[model samples]
Target: MTREPTVAEQSHPNYVKVWGVLVALLAVSVVGPMFEIKLVTLVTAFGVAILKAYLVARNFMHLHIERRYVTYLLVGMVALMLLLFAGVAPDVMKHEGHQWKNEAAQKVVRDAAPAAKVH
Candidate 1:
């Protein structure tokens, strides 16, 4: 015999609507670069990506209904990631070593800076 859903389960979000929103966001992200505008593409792709992640985590993972500690843990993990990236970035970004220099990497950074500033 099939069991009936609890009140909590019945009160859960409309999954179809959530999925439709995700699909629409995906389409926007995919089509964003076609406009060839750097700012628009960046906003659409990254903004949509962050929103999509939130929707999946909040809806599918049910993170919003979880205890406060789970939210703290998630924030802590993200903070740690940012810290780790900051720690590693300087060394990775340094194109000059003790003896050798990474001309290609430096060139790319130099080339991209002006383009980035223009947009």
Candidate 2:
């Protein structure tokens, strides 16, 4: 015998609605870059991405119905990602002429080498 869906499951929004919302968010992200304003386009794209992520996690992954600990874990994961990016940002932003120094050293070495005697 087939079992009926629980009341909680029935109370959730229909899958089609969730899918439609995801599709709309995706469209927004895709169209956002067409704007000439760089900041506005970036914000719009990231905003849509966050919204789509939330919808997928809550509805498709059933995180909304899960316990509080699961939500906390998700939040922690996001925090960890932010921390990692923060740690890497400074290194990415700073450059101390290392490339130029390497090129200068190479040129000096090439100049010191004796010319080969060709037959």
Candidate 3:
């Protein structure tokens, strides 16, 4: 014996459509670099990635049917990630003086000099 799909199942968005949208978003991400605009390409790739993530989460992970608390948790996680990135951004962007090269050159000169002969 076989069972028919329920009304809820019938009302859900078609899996094929969702998969096609994901593929289209992936294509956008792949082709975004061809434009030769760094900011635009980055934004396009990230946007497509976010969209694809949403689609997968909603359809495959069934987040669309999840409770409000789950949504809140996801939002909180995203906020925390942004906060962490902001906290680290300044240190990551800082360009400290290039002391390594000077140290390397000095070490080379020091090593090149002949060692004194021990009696």
Candidate 4:
């Protein structure tokens, strides 16, 4: 018969090591933003952010140490984050000539003759 792991066997060296590694990852992320980087800087910055968060959630938060519903919770959080990130670019970059209408309105205001009636 197969044996189920006792709590002690399942949580030991790896658990402590995980917390240490998670701390290191967090330090790296905190330091990543302090550098005087150039145009491609954001790529690396956010990359570190993602890595650190993953480590914390999966390790320190012990999401991987799931007992019952934690797995679903972590998966759901990750999925929701993915969805939000996926939709962000389109939401930020999309403009279908709506800005042009704003420009036209400004021009109309600028070109309008002084109103002959002031109440």
List, residue by residue over 4-94, the lDDT tens digit for candidate 1: 6543473489889999999999999999989989999998999889999999988877778776798899999999999999998977879
lDDT of every model, 2 decimals: 0.88, 0.77, 0.76, 0.64
Q: Write the per-residue lDDT of candidate 4 for residues 1-119, one digit (tens) a residue.
A: 99986534554447667668767766766676677575335655677667777776665555566575867776789899989989886644443354534555555665664652341
Displacement of the residue 26 alpha carbon in candidate 3, Å: 0.9
| Model 2 alpha-carbon miss at residue 66, Å | 0.5
Candidate 3 TM-score, true structure as reference: 0.66
For model 2, residues 2-114, the per-residue Cα lDDT tens digits are: 99665357457688999998898888888888886898788779978888888888787778777779899989999999999999876554433555345555565566675
**Candidate 2 TM-score to native:** 0.67
Rank by lDDT, descending? Answer: 1, 2, 3, 4
Q: After superposition, how far is residue 114 of candidate 4 from its true place, in Å?
A: 29
TM-score winner between candidates 1 and 4:
1
Tell me the tens digit of each residue's lDDT in model 3 across 1-113: 78965434634768898898888888889888789799878877987788888888888767767666888999899999999999987555543345524456556566767
Worst 10 residues of 2 by lDDT: 93-102
lDDT assessment of candidate 3: 0.76
Give the candidate number with the greatest TM-score: 1
The TM-score between candidate 4 and the true structure equals: 0.46
Provide the TM-score for each candidate, comma-separated.
0.72, 0.67, 0.66, 0.46
Error of 2 at 106 (Å): 17
Which candidate wins on lDDT?
1
Q: Which pairs in model 3 have colliding backbones?
A: none
